[model samples]
Structure formats: C-alpha cells, structure tokens
Target: MGRRKSHGSSKSKQHVTHQRQLSLAKRNEINALCEKLFVCEYAFHTALSINSAYVTQLWDNYVEISTILEKVKRLEEMKTESPKRSQGIGQFINWLKENGANLDGASVAEFPGYDLGLKAERNFQENELILRIPRGLIFSTHNAAPELIAILNDPLIQHMPQVALAIALLIERHKENSKWKPYLDILPTTYMTVLYMTAADMIELKGSPTLEAALKQCRNIARQYSYFNKVFQNNNNAVSAILRDVFTYERYW
Candidate 1:
C-alpha cells in the first residue's frame, strides 16, 4: 500500500449521521480477522524451507484439516439418497417454451447424482438447434435497468453489472407476479459456494493460497456488505426504497 498524497484537507474527519452505520464492534472484528488471516500467510513463509520445526508445526494443522475432509468425503460417497428436484421443473419448462424457447426435442430431467439437466427427447443432427431464448426472456443488467433506474448513478451498480443483475433477480423473486417465478422457484435455497463454507471448513485450505484468497474475499464482502447496509438503510433509490424494509442480507447475497 502506498501513502496518499495530502491535498491540504483536515486530518480530523466529520461524521455525518446515517440511517445506518457500520457497528464499531463488527468493524473491529473484521479488521482482526483480516490481520489473523494475513498472519497465517506470514507464518507460512516466515521460516526457511530447510526448517524441520516449521514443517512439523504446519503438518499438525494439515492433519486436523484432513481428518474433517476425509469424514465429509466418505459420508458423501456413501450416501445413497438422490433427491430429484421436481418442485417446479414442469412449470419452468412450460414457461420457457411458452415464451420463445425451441425445446421440441429437449426436456429437463434429473439424473441420478446429477441434479437436473436437459435431456434429448429425440435424436438430432449435428449443429441442429435444440434451444433458443428470446431477448425478452433473458435476464441481464440491460433488461433489468428500468427497475433499478434510481440507483443507476451509484458507483457500485455502475461498476458491478453482476451485482446489479443479482439485485434485480432478488427484486423480481420477491414479487408475486414475477415472470421468472417458475425458474426461481425451482432453484435451490442455498448453494455450496465458498461463501457457504464455514470458518472450520476454511481450515481445510490452510496450506493453500486458496485459504488467503477466501479470507480476503470474505473481508472484502463484509466491507461491501457494510457499505450497502448503509445505502439500503439511508438512501431511497429504487434498490433501497423497496429493499430497505424487508432486505435480509441473505437474499442480497
């Protein structure tokens, strides 16, 4: 990190009242966690490669993590239950076809161990079209901009198209008359992404750079969460106007 050039501004800053503010304790906690994560990385490279004591100490963390991984892996491999996601597949497929998708030869089905996928109902020649979605049916920041026009000037939405699309998806999902209801309804309540990993699960990546990457990502997300937490609380932009009242962070995620 480089030092910022002073532009003759006062060192002491004014604290403007906000409808929401990041809690001092949570801010401190995030700082502490980031420090600890960096320290772990520092400890990794602190000693020379020839240091036996260093290697031995790191090995203990490895063994602890490996035990949990093996148990989890074994349990998953042994599981026989293959739950088919049949909740709203029919409705979603019907909705897609009704709109503009070409699916005469393809249908969605759940295979064992594979949650859900498109299955061929009949043979098709090479390069034949099996599906086509209309522009109006596709979800993207471009299509969703009108609903979020009030926050278009906000830097986060301007810079992060993915975030904007995600917010739009959530907004639509909450509406009783959403066009994407059938599709969203069939989606899982949660996913197994790194965000879903627990702190203990993070330990499994101890010796890997992935651990640091995950930590950095978590801290970054936390900071952003605080920023948006304030935004949703204080501003009455399209996003804040409707979300501020019922916005649980989980849905935002």
Candidate 2:
C-alpha cells in the first residue's frame, strides 16, 4: 500500500512538471511571433509616415512596436475567451489605430478579429480619418483614467480633421495650469497621457482656489458656450477656430 501511494505522488509531480514545460514553451513561441509582427507593422506604418513632421521626427518606431509586442506577450497566457482580455485587446487596438494615424497620417489596417475602429466610426468611413495616439501615453504597464486619457487616447477625437483640434484642446487645457506644465511640455518625448492631463491641469489653473473649483469653472464655461463645446467635441473647423481665437486672446492679454 505504501508503494502504491508513493507511485501516485511521483506521477502527479511528473504531470505538473510537464504542464510547466508546455507553458514555458508556448511563451517562447509567442515571443518569437510577436517579434515578427512588430517588424512587419513598423515597416508598413513607416512607409506611410512620410512628409509629416510629427511622424518623421521620431525616425524609428521602436517604442510603438515594442508596446504592441508587450501587449501580445500578456495575451499569450490569457484565456482567449475572457471578457477582460477582450476588452484589454480592444483598448490596445484603439491605441494602435490612433498612434498609426498621428504618426503616419494614415489609418492602420484593421486587426484580424477585432473591429473597434469600425464600431467607433459614425459613418461609412467617408469623412472618417486616421486617429493617431500620442506616443508618450502608450503603455504596456497599466490602464489610465478615461477622462485623462481622452486628452490623448479618445477614439472620438484622434482622427484626421479632429486631430489638430484635439491637440488644441489639449494645449489649452495644459497651458491653464502651471503645476501640471512639467507634465504637459510640448516636447517630442511627451507621452499622450501627460499631454492630456497637463492640458486639464492648465484649464484648472484658471480657478486656483481648488482643483475641484477649477474643474467646475471649466465645465461651466464650456457648457455655457457652444463654441467651447464644439471645440471640446474636436471638430476640425472648431479646433482651427479655437486655435485662432486662442492666439487672438493671448495677444490681447
């Protein structure tokens, strides 16, 4: 009886070891696949990025490609059917689309099984344009807040016509707050999250009494003025007009 019990324990240990080995092997294969995908994506997007100062300025797309690679690695061990994984992949897809547009000035080709961009589109892709994400905000680390992310990652605001407007809104929002300026610097390395948060910081600066107070004032003012809401909505013309008005207002001040 003791011999039988020992035999059973040994078998169990062997099974566990086999499972671990399988998992490790799978992970290594995933890493290799991700490397191949990254190179392909970078090559495809870089070709389209010509002539744009923003995209050309970066030279190499290692940062963006690495982010996608990291995300794929996380997905390798995850259950493909899990809702959380699906949502995460969805968000990552959006991040890619936006970054592609911001840098390449062209919409990224769709993912095989995911269609977040198609769902986000209001029309049949006529007026719809590429939605580029600010490189600084793309992270394989953690999820960012929705509002703060909207400053850089909002699907509704990243497209062609709206891209410039989004940048203006972000800039205005950042310039208003001195405390957040360090995060909002208009430098090449600024992450999109920092830009958006800093922009919010700037707008909040107007009502210096408190963070809450500043938020309230900005919301109230934006709500009161249709133009403000339009600008916030991030229409191309609205953003252009807002940019003009901002300069005009600055000149007077």
Candidate 3:
C-alpha cells in the first residue's frame, strides 16, 4: 500500500502564505499613512508661514494612523524585556555615601521585566526621611546655566531653560573628570518616551488624545533638532564648540 499522504506540511505552507499576505498588506497600509504624513509635513515646511491649519491637518493624519494602528496586533518572544543593570550603580552609591548622601537603608535592585528600582531595605514611619541626596548630587539648572552662558542669548537657550540644562548635561557627560560620571554612568540609555515607541506601540495609544500630544511633541523636537543642528554647524562659541562635535539628535532626544 502507498504511504498515507500527510497534510501537515501543506497546512503549514498555507499558514505561512497567509501570514506573508497579511504582513504585506499591513506594510502597504502603514506606508500609505506615512506618505500622507510626508505630504502634510511638506506643506508646512514650504508654507510662507506656519498656521494652526497645517498642525491640524497633520494631527488629523496622526489620528487616522493611530486609529488604524490601534487594532489588535500581536507578537512577542520568550526573551524577557528589562532595563540593563548598570555596573556603575554600586560606584554611584559609594560616591553618594562618601559625599554625605544617606541611602543606608535603601538599595538599587533589579526586578524581572522592570527597570532598576530602589528597594527599601527597611520600612519607615510617616514623616521620617526615606533617603537623602545632597544638593551637590542634583544636576539642577542653577548648576547648568553658568557653563552655557556663552550661548545664553540664543533663543533656544534663553526661552528654554531645560534646553540649557540639557546642554549642560552633555558637557558634563563629555568631561574626563566629571564629578557626575558615576551618576551619568549609571543612567539608563533608554527612556519610556514616545520616540522609542514602535509603530505598533503607538497604535496601542490610538484612541487616546495622548497619541496626538506625543506626535506633536515629536514634531516640535524634530524642528528644534534641525534648528540646533544648523546653529551648531555655523556658530562657534564656548557651548557650540563643544556641542558641534558631540551633540546628536539621538542623544538630545
């Protein structure tokens, strides 16, 4: 008798073909939405002056894309997701202790699938201080402003104190003998920001107005980045000199 024909391989092939088709369709839909975005973006870029209309149009586009993307999508691997535990954390703690910052009862601990978190070693009563970080440990705008005084007149730095502080951070991080090296070294490279979101992830937020806010923020940041890039390229000053070589949109974001 002839060996019985197995249908499993044929079914598997059919499943593979279906998935390919679905993936191709999804890609085409996403591409079309992106193209729409480009067209709206170009209109704004080329306009004589930006107005509410351009932003509204783009926002509408984001809403459309977000709505489509918010649909049920699925996939993930067994590989667990978690922020990396920095080796510098220990050194940072030691440095803080040496500097009179008290964290004697709290320790940095890693939880599975979560970022490095400070775990309380001992419970405390109300009104009691849980921990204390010295003023020197704080990288405040007060500390950042003096270093960026050269470009303080620039509108970006003048209006945006946060931008000034950010630049200050860049300078400190770049320094060989930076006092904040331990803190900076322990800082996670990734953040829970919209810039890091996958298209699918953005889709998950589709129904919410927060999606629009996130998109607007992204657009504004891109514009600021372009402006800064131009300034850094042409302007030669104390801040620009250092940043022109090292400042990057990725780092800025």
Q: Which candidate is the best by TM-score?
A: 3
Give lDDT: candidate 3, residue 241.
65
> Which predicted model would earn the best lDDT?
3
| Model 2 C-alpha lDDT per residue in residues 44-97, reported as the tens digit of each score | 343533344423333233334334434543533322111222233333444445
Sort by TM-score, top down from the best: 3, 1, 2
lDDT of 1 by residue, 1-253 (tens): 0001111111132111112433566445433433332333224555555344664455444444334333422322221221234655777788998888878889888777767788999999999998888898787766643667777777987898776776676666543355666665556555666555665786687676465456555444444444565667678676676555434334444
Which candidate do you rate higher for lDDT, 2 or 3? 3
Q: Model 2: C-alpha RMSD to truth?
A: 26.1
Per-residue lDDT, model 1, residue 105, is 87
Alpha carbon deviation, residue 50, candidate 1 (Å): 19
What C-alpha lDDT do the candidate models reach, one value each? 0.54, 0.32, 0.56
Worst 10 residues of 2 by lDDT: 1-10
Model 3, runs deviating above 4 Å: 1-56, 59-85, 203-207
TM-score of predicted model 3?
0.65
The backbone clash count of each candidate, in order, is 0, 12, 0
lDDT, candidate 1, at 158: 89
RMSD of 3: 15.9
